[model samples]
Target: MESEALLSVRDLRIAFAGVEAVRGLSFDVRPREVLALVGESGAGKSLTARALLGMVPEDATTSGTVTLLGDTDLAAQRGLHIALVPQDALSALSPVHPVGDQLAAAVRSVARVSRKEARARAVAALDRVGIPDAARKARAYPHEYSGGMRQRAVIAMATVNEPDVLVADEPTTALDEERRDQVLRVLGEQREALGAALVLVTHDMDVVRDHADRVLVMYAGRLTELGPADAVLGRPRAPYTAGLLASLPEHDAPRRRRLPALPGTPPAPGTLPPGCAFAPRCPLAADLCHREEPEPQEVEGHLVACHHWAELPHPAVDLFQEKQHASS
Candidate 1:
């Protein structure tokens, strides 16, 4: 583990019934930085996020070292040093309890404080997340709050204990564009205020571009690319990363034209193809790609896993656009 890393994950693997979902993953979370994990829906991003807090299902088998501040026992430090902001807000909160009371209970679980002090801290956390009239709103049940309010309340609960690391799994997936921005803003603000590192899991590339300091691109339960967000998103080296970015609807492109899309769906676990899992869909794949999987290697400061990453065109999106045109 690096001395400066707040959290370190080494060769993390999660399997179910002899099938691996997250395969041999490694990364480090620096202090007060935003690390975004992105890929298609079945890329094992959510499972990896849950593994950080030892929150995987009972049936799943996990092996790895998730070390936080030199401690490998993640369960012991769960709520106090690490926390999770799950994808669904309504399901995470209890309907019968007032929002404030739930947050107060969270604070009490991690700290030795009087009921009045815990309540005060709970209201303060709510107010800090931009909840209006927090003292009064705190008394309301989860069912009483609006969609966005419930989301904010969840954020308050996660940060009430001031954990060292926060893991949010698709926190803005269900929101509209306006609401998405608001929720991300609140999350960023809370991250800054708490001075804690954040592990953000989402499928939105725009979110990664705007908010992440570093980006980890996963495919078929393995890392495809990892680097500073600006370098990786701006000039993706891996073919899988390039294909994902090319599929996005460009802001300045003609509105009527069809956007480029990846050719096929992600392979199911335990049914991956020989050699590279992405070889079947990758336009740049060669005979070697089908015969041997490429390991991540440093290329211009980015860790890229592709046999021909060096040969990829500077504007990689052009390659995918040309492929779409040829097929048409």
Candidate 2:
């Protein structure tokens, strides 16, 4: 583990019934840094995030060294030093208990604090997340609040203990554009208040551009690229990263133009081919890409796992448009 890293994951692998969902994933998150884990569904982004907090299901087997806050084994130190704001706030919060009670329980579970103090902290947390009339809202149940409010409550609960690392999995997945940005702003504000490292797991490139200091692109359970967000998004080296960017609908594109999409679906986990998982989809893939899996190699300053990354054209340069023009 790096001494300066607030959380470090090395060779993290997770399997369920002998089917691997995450393979050889690794990264380091420093304090107050925001790292976005970006990938489409079933890319193992969510699974990797859950593995960080020791929340993987009983049927799943996970192996990795997650060092954080002096604990090499993060499983034993979850909730005390690491927290998770899970995707579904409704399911994460209890239906029977008042939001305040549940939050107080979280605080009291780890600290030797009085019930009164815990409740006070809970109310304060809600206020910090921009929940108005927090004292009154804290007395309400999860059902009593709207989607965004409930999400804010979840953020409040996750940060109540002041954990060293906060993992928010798709925190704004269900909201519309305005609401999505609002929830994201709250998440960012809470992280800044606690000065905790944040691992934001999402597929939204816009979210990554706005909030992330660093980005990790995962494809078929393997890391395809990792580097600073600006470079990875602007000048992506990995074909998978390029494909994702090309697939995004350009706001400035001509009216009624078809949005470019990656031609094929991602390979199923545990059933990927012997070579690079993305070889089938990469336009620049050659015989070497299909014969030997490429290990992550340093290109310029970023890490990329592509046999022909240097030869491929930049994603921003008419790659997707050329394809569209050819089809038309």
Candidate 3:
């Protein structure tokens, strides 16, 4: 592991029974960098995050190296340098405990702080995430807080320890428009203050554009593409990636119609598509693309797993820019 990297995942694999959720995944999170994992639901973003934090469900099994600023991979370190906020907000919190209390308990559970200190820390955490009158809010039960507040409370708990790296699974999922912006801003502020590498798992392109320095696009169980946010979002080279972007509603685009999406849902886990997992739905797929997997290839600093990447046009500057603009 490089001293510059706060977290690194290499050849990470995870499975439930015979079905793999993540396969041969590798990535690095440099110190103070924000990496966004963007993909549709069930595309292995959350599962990859869960495996790093050792939070996978009981029926699953995980493997591979997840190194964090040292020779030790997470498989060996047991999340000593990592912390996470899970995907499902509703089930993540304890229903009976006061949200504040539960958050304070998280501090004690992680770092052995005294109750008074933990409560103080808890109040501070809430305040850090933009809760007004944090102490009063802390005293309220989970049921007492509104959905947005609950989400904030969860963030407070996850960030309390100020770990070297933070994994946030859909942090803004439950928020309304105003609250979503607030949540995003809070995360940005928190990242600045904590100086922890943030791994944000989200499907929203706008969030990816606004917050991420780099984007990791996963399809099926594999990491399909990764690059600087501007490069990947601006001119994605993989067909699957291009399809996803083409499908997004571009408010800035001149076109009035919403957008066009690729046909067919994601393939099931145990039975991923034979070749490029996305070959069935990829418009540019060829016979070779359906029978042989593409190894990760580096383009500048970006990584792409596509058999026909060189043949695929740059969507923004070359092929889809006009279409992208009109969609808005």
| Residue pairs of candidate 2 with colliding backbone atoms | none
Off by over 4 Å in 2: 1-3, 315-317
Best-to-worst order by TM-score is 1, 2, 3
lDDT (0 to 1) per candidate = 0.93, 0.87, 0.80
lDDT of 2 by residue, 222-271 (tens): 88999999999999998788878887877888778776677688888767
Residue 160 lDDT in model 2? 93
Instruction: Give all TM-scores, in the order shown.
Output: 0.98, 0.96, 0.90
Weakest 10 consecutive residues, lDDT, candidate 2? 314-323
Q: Specify the highest-lDDT model's number.
A: 1
> Can you write out model 1's per-residue Cα lDDT over 22-49, one digit (the tens) per residue?
9899989999999999999889999999
lDDT of 2 at 234: 91
Look at candidate 1 and tell me the lDDT of residue 63: 91
List pairs with backbone clashes in candidate 3: 66-74, 250-328, 253-325, 253-328, 255-326
> Considering every candidate listed, which one attains the maximal TM-score?
1
